[model samples]
Target: MTTISKTRIDGMPIGLTLALLLACAVNLAVLARWL
Candidate 1:
C-alpha cells in the first residue's frame, strides 16, 4: 500500500491524490472514533 501510494504520489492524477487524502482522513476519523 505504501509503495502504491508513493508511486501514485509521484505520478498519479490529482483525482487520485484527492481520493487518497480522503481515504486517509476517513481512516483517521474512524480510528479516532474508536479510541
Candidate 2:
C-alpha cells in the first residue's frame, strides 16, 4: 500500500513548477502562433 502524506509541502513545489512550466510552454506557443 502506498501512503501519501499531506502534511508536507514537498509534492506541492514540484507540482507547481511543472504547472508553471506547462503554462510557459503554452504561452510561448501562443506567442509563436501570433508572430
Candidate 3:
C-alpha cells in the first residue's frame, strides 16, 4: 500500500485515507476469519 501512503503524504484528505485504512483492515480481518 505504498501508493496509498504516498497519496496520503501528498495531501489526500484525512477522512478518505482513514476510510481506506479501515476498509483494508476489515477486509484482512474477514479473510483471516474465513481462512
lDDT for position 32 in model 2: 100
Q: Which candidate comes out best when scored by lDDT?
A: 1
Q: Cα deviation in Å at residue 30, candidate 1?
A: 0.3
Return model 3's CA RMSD, one decimal.
2.8
Task: Using TM-score, give the best candidate's number.
Answer: 1
lDDT of each structure?
0.91, 0.75, 0.87
Off by over 4 Å in 2: 1-12
Residue-level lDDT for 26 in candidate 3:
100
lDDT of 1: 0.91
Q: Please report, as a residue range, the 10-residue window in candidate 3 with the lowest summed lDDT.
A: 5-14
C-alpha positional error of residue 34 in candidate 3 after TM-score superposition, expressed in Å? 0.3
What tens-digit string does per-residue lDDT give for candidate 3 at 1-35?
99986976669777877888899999999999999
Look at candidate 1 and tell me the lDDT of residue 22.
100
Tens digit per residue, CA lDDT, model 1, 10-31: 8988898899899999999999
- Summed backbone clashes in each candidate are 0, 0, 0
Give the residue spans of candidate 1 off by over 4 A: 1-8
- TM-scores of all models? 0.72, 0.63, 0.71
- Poorest 10 consecutive residues of model 2 by lDDT? 1-10
Q: State the TM-score for model 2.
A: 0.63
